[model samples]
Target: MNDLDIRCAAPSDIAAVLRFWREAAEGTSITDDHEGVARLISRDPEALLLAEQDGRITGTVIAGYDGWRCSAYRLAVHPDRRRQGIATALMDAAERRFLALGGRRIDAMVLESNERAHRTWGSAGYHREGHWRRWVKSVRP
Candidate 1:
């Protein structure tokens, strides 16, 4: 396996990232569109982290810090590229970025049914918070 190149996503990478997520991610998000992603890159240039090898996107993770809380989203790895340490590399980069930004804690939003993701996150020392539940409301709709 070639060493994956891990870095922040640029505006030019938005389309490829959306395509990659459609193929690799478990589920879609409401804001997975080009405009949303572009807006994210525009707002926080280093929030979306990507892993590539041989010119193909292998994995991605959104490590967003709003100067207060650090949250991770869209942690996806290509189906064919799973178990090849790509996710780990992406997480490593994300953690480093968070630490550099003085983030004290990091939280990830993983689906309850995504056992693979649970295992991945567990291996990285993340535990599920049974005491807390997430509530959401779409402001756009």
Candidate 2:
């Protein structure tokens, strides 16, 4: 394997990213389309991180920080590239971004059904918060 290039997503990369997610990511999101991703990069240029190896995107993670919280989402690696430190590298980069932004802690959004993600996050020192459950409503226009 070659050295991984971890970088922010550009506007031109949105289409490729959506395609990559379809193949590599475990699940889908309401904001997985081109417009949503473009909005993300437009709003916060550094929030979306991509892992590239030999000119192909192999992994990705969204590291978003509001004034009050640091949220991580969309952590995915290519099926063929699992257990190869790509996810770790992406998380490391996200953690560094949060730390630089004065973030005290990180909250990652991992799907409950993804047992593989559970182990992956657990090994990264994240534990499930048994007391709290997420509540959400889609405000689509």
Best by lDDT: 2
lDDT of 1 by residue, 70-137 (tens): 99999999999999999988999999999999999999999999999999999999999999999987
Clashes per prediction? 0, 0
CA shift of 139, model 1, Å: 1.7
**Candidate 2: residue pairs that collide:** none
Deviation from native of the Cα of residue 48 in model 1, angstroms: 0.4
Q: Which portions of model 1 show Cα errors greater than 4 Å?
A: none
